[model samples]
Target: MKRSNAKIISTTFIILLSIFCFFKSTPVKADSLTAKYSMDIELNGAKKTLAGKENVSVHNSSGADLKELVFHLYPDLYNKRETMPFSYTNTKNVPLTEEEKGDISIEKVLINGEDTKFTEDNEILKINLEKNLKKNDNVNVSIQFSLKIPKGTSRLSYFNDVYSLADWYPVLSIYDLKENRWDETKFYPIGESNYSDVSEYDINIKVPKDFVVVSTGKEKEISSTDNKKVINLTAKNARDFIIMISPYFKCISKEIDGIKVNSYYLSTDDKSLVDIAQSVLDASVNAMKFFSQQFGKYPYDEFDIVESYYEGGAMEYPELIQMPKYVTSIEIQTPSTKRYIDAKPSIIQGAIHELCHQWWYVTVGNNEYKEPFLDESFATFFTAYYFEKCEGQYSPNAVLRSLRYSFSKLAEINPKILNLPCAGSSVDKFGNDKTSYVQAIYVRAPLILEDLRKMVGQDSFLKIMQTYFKEYKFKNSSIEGFLNIIEKQAGSKIRDYIGDEIYSGEYKAENLKPTDEEINQIKHETLKEKIKASEQANGSVLGSLLLRVENGEKAIIVKPSSLTKEEEAFVNSKLKSYFGNSYNKLSIQSDNSVTENELKNSNIVLIGNPWNNKIFSLMANNIPLSINKTRVFAQSFSENSDSVSGIFSAKNPKNDQNIMLAIFWTKDVSTDFYFDTYANPESIMIESQFILSIDNKRIETGKF
Candidate 1:
């Protein structure tokens, strides 16, 4: 999943952290009892329903007799809002319509071609066998069902003419040998809840000819007619099967190391949108290459990345992933007014993270509801590792710094979080607070892995992971099993070191807390990097005041005392829109009420000319541009025309570490266009100096 929130620590010490090691190998797997599923499903697009019949062949590997077969009816959870795992608040508080409600109806069930007694409740289906089966027995269970596709964004949902079908079928539950029972954990909305054994799938899907189908395995077009089409898909040793259908799907493909990778995106005429899709494609290819070399060879011949509507971050399936459409929809206007070529870093990071699941969750399976950190943490750690080795736009140190910062801030809010066990706790333990859930599983869990790497050295850590992958390929592993692997490779001391941290969740929070000096240094370096990169690439400054404020720096907006209350409210509203949640940290004061301490320590945005704004008057000499009652002075020229306005930033006179951004006009300028243009981080160009006319036309803009 893409991290919705942000993380801590020192620079010189962190740079010494060992880099992850990469390895290459041939494909390998461990033999185990498995299930083979054959399904024929047809989609009724007009009614938003799927009618299907499924036959599952299961081999008993529990070393004991079985009396019944259990399956998870995941789609039934969506039958009503009350049964759904997720909160309606997360869905923008929009109630689901009757047509939007989803449900799965089991019309008939059979065991070995004979009628069987069955019960369905709480999203679980249990079929009682006619007689107790012996050890190592095989059973064929057939189910006929129909499904209603919900209208929304989720793992199994339909929205905007696209259908995302995952866990849309009744899947046989895993039999836990230790407990002598089937794994029947209920679906939890906070984290991944679908848990099943690796199975072989032979699926036949029938859809409208206009609908393009993307699914888990190798797909072959079977037949096509004027209005109907049939496709056959076969997947071997896959943990789960998923399908996506859309008539507006556009595709791009690349082959890496004999593995064909395809990226399916929504059809769009906008060239920029296509470029964003291409970016995701490129990131997926790079991540696959990096993870395959580092952990183990990718066993599959094909991988699919589908861009669709998902409420949260991207989700990982067996051979396919769901990439959020929001990534392609996002556009940032650069100083040159050209759309930024790079998509949001979250999209790139999300692509890499989800692909990592192919190695961890897909091939080497784990019970996600029981131990989500096993896959999520490992995926996140490898994401940082990819940046560290690939040397892309973001570096490992940058990633580490961000993580550390987030941890420290969260720790400040609730010190007890420092003692919470992320590795040992199950997903349900975190409850409904997604923030705390992410903080523990996604944020702190990876830091624990990094700490382990530092303790065992990079080479030993590499050997441990490689051995874990090789041993657990096509098998499910527990926390104990992973610890044994670490102990084998890194010895007892190293195992104990990580074991204590994982079980106790007691981390050295003080060590991770970054010092104020380090924070300031990073702030300055980031500002410099942004300016240098933007200038070198497009000759425009890309840094914005909003960025600084978002970094947790104190900010104050100083307006002229003569300004009307309505004008102040307008400025505040614009700032709120620009800053979003970060706006609450900002303060607004009249020039008469502004204090000297604020000028020295806080980032100041002066909203009036020197003549009317006292704080601007005090700092006029230090700024790059000069603004007075009659004219605005630039570095090379001066404008005396009425309505001439200037916006510039410079070091605060009282404190060089702070910044002072000033927006002043020679006369009464049109506040509508001026504030609407300059106050917005997306519209304003980042330069030390900028001059504009009352009509919102650019007069002069440059950096000092």
Candidate 2:
């Protein structure tokens, strides 16, 4: 699932009291125990219900007498608003209407062809065995159940003509023989909480003929009539089965390296939306191809990316993923315009992030409730690797820089947050504070892997991952088990190094900081890339000038030594709004004291009358627009008025290749004509030269 930035209600008091009682359970090897499910369900769209009969065949090979069976009824979490684990305060603290509540009811349960008594409580279903079945014993359990699909946005809900079904079935819970207990972790409101052993599934669904269904496995057979359709799907060695149905879904498919990749989206007549769907399909294909080669091969032959209405970002299943429709449905508002921004970059990043889960959480399973970082942190790190190698939009260095900057800002509010342990932490450890959970698991945990990568070198780190994946495929792994693999591949000292950080979370915060030289290098590379892209598109010079300043290029704002208080205030306010905390980096030099070298080396912003500003006077001939005390002149047009104002960009005479000279001159120095017109410099085109009147009207505009 994509991490949400939304804040959650604090449960610090509850957490502190329960923190000492947390214990780790030892994993039990139950390879001999196999579960195969055959389910037949019918969906009633009007009633928002799914009535199904499930026949499960369980084979016990644990060499121990089985006394009882346990299953997780995840949908029960939504039976009442109080038990739901929504991170947002509105959902967590408020009551949900009856129509917005979801739940599952087991009407009947039969074991070995006999009616059996069962108990259900707190999302757990247990059936006491009538007889102690010896090793190699097999039992067939038949369950009749009905699910009330809620009218809201969630993993299991009906919203906007879409039904997303995840964790909606009575899944046999993983039992630890060593601990002599079932893994009965409740559904968490934030992050993932489902954990199960790999099982085979043969599912049959009957829905309205118009509804299109996308699920975890391949569609093996289909039969439909005039009003209804029944689809048969099969999945082998899958951790869980998920299904999504919508009447308006349209599918586009492509074959990548022998794997058939399908993208299911809401049908739309808009060409732009169709294009976005295609981009999502392409990104999924690219991610699958890249991860297949890097990690182990994707065992499944079919993959699906289904767009649905789910608020929790994107979710991953066995061979399928659920993407939020808003990824392509929303429009963003910028300072200059409200337009549908290109969502391809976001699609790529999000798609890759979920696709990496196939390897971390699906093929190589882990106990998410006990050790979420095992899957989430690895998926995050691998997603970075995919971007760094396949896509340049988010390189590893850039991701690290952004993470460090975000953590530093959070530290500003509470420095102790830096000491929160993440590696061995469980979902319950953080209680209801989803923000802190994300910081520790998603942000800090990945950095620990990155530190290990830097310590052991890239080659050994890759080997360690490949070995871990190969060893733990189709089984649940623990953090200590992963560290043991690391020790086997690398040295014991390397294992201890990571173990200390994981257990104590006491790494030096200074390590997160990038040195000044590294910062400069990043800025230099960014400026070069922006310049190249702008030149390729024949963009405006004004755009390139702003890009240089934003990338940390030296910039100075020159004003006349003599200025009215109003003019000074205007300059200071605009500067403060534009630069925020970084305003100190930009020097406001008086025209009298500005040096010749500064004018030549820096991206100069001359903001006064051309006659009074020395920097503007020096470059008046080289600039595209000619400004005077009462008039502004461009190459094609001239505006002569007391309120005439203009802004333009030109190559610096001394350093044409690297430096830019931009001037914002006005006839009325006290007026904020320039700032008002160029509030969002990025919206301006490159090489732009414009003249405007004080009434906020454009008199003349052209490119240099």
Best by lDDT: 1
Candidate no. 2 TM-score: 0.75
Clash number for candidate 2: 7
TM for every model, in the order presented, reads 0.73, 0.75
* CA lDDT of every candidate: 0.74, 0.73
RMSD (Å) of each candidate, 1 decimal: 15.5, 11.9
lDDT measured at residue 507 in model 1 versus the true structure, 0 to 100: 69
User: What pairs collide in candidate 2?
Assistant: 85-189, 539-686, 540-685, 540-686, 540-687, 541-686, 541-687
lDDT of 1 at 521: 54
What's model 2's overall lDDT? 0.73
Clashing pairs in 1: 7-402, 7-403, 7-404, 7-405, 7-406, 8-403, 8-404, 8-405
